[model samples]
Target: MFGFGIPELLIIGAIVMLIFGVGKLPELGSSFGKAISNFRKAADGKDMIELNSKKDG
Candidate 1:
């Protein structure tokens, strides 16, 4: 998995925290989760586009 071990992940996490700050981490995590969910739905051909349009209308 891209050869990322615990030390590498901790370094990456520290970088992200420095950039986004602790206060916004929760918001960022939520948005990231939603993006992943949408990506999975799209990969499964779930017609997300139509569903979003229907909700808006």
Candidate 2:
């Protein structure tokens, strides 16, 4: 894991918690997951955009 052991990861995680605080962590994680998901879809030649339309009668 890039030469990062448990102690180094703990320190890094602590720093992130201090910087972003506790509340914003889940929001950040959600955005990160979405970004990776989109990246994978694009890499796999899948359409990442959706369009919806309705016709009025």
Candidate 3:
């Protein structure tokens, strides 16, 4: 709730909707969700990193 009332939350939601628009809002939300997911996965050591080493002739 963050101490916000119905009216205050409505105002904030309206502003966010206006700024992002209904069409792109879902995409933004999905992207945010993915970023959070990836961060969590990395923290849990689930992310993979590849490194290549070259042999000297």
Candidate 4:
């Protein structure tokens, strides 16, 4: 992803550490996970709008 190799990945990780700090890694990871989950649900048309429409009819 993003055409990164080992060296590039390490550099990107270092930048993230600088930006977000080690103490916030878990919070960032969890929020990223939730965003990814929501993106997948949206792509599959399984989000709240779809559920509500199904219920109304």
**Among all candidates shown, the one with the greatest lDDT:** 2
Expressed as tens digits, the lDDT of each residue in 1-57 for candidate 1 is: 899999999999999999999999999999999999988999998845553444554
Q: Write the per-residue lDDT of candidate 4 for residues 1-57, one digit (tens) a residue.
A: 778899999998999999999999999999999999999999997885633445555
**Pairs of colliding residues, candidate 1:** none
Clashes of each: 0, 0, 0, 0
Ranking by lDDT: 2, 3, 1, 4
Q: Cα deviation of 9 in candidate 4 (Å)?
A: 0.3
| Index of the highest-TM-score prediction | 2
How well does model 3 score by local distance difference test? 0.93
lDDT of 2 by residue, 1-57 (tens): 899999999999999999999999999999999999988999997955787888899
TM-score for candidate 4: 0.77
Assess candidate 1 and give its lDDT: 0.92
Rank by TM-score, highest first: 2, 4, 1, 3
Whichever of 2 and 4 has more TM-score, that candidate is 2
Alpha-carbon local distance difference test for all models:
0.92, 0.94, 0.93, 0.91
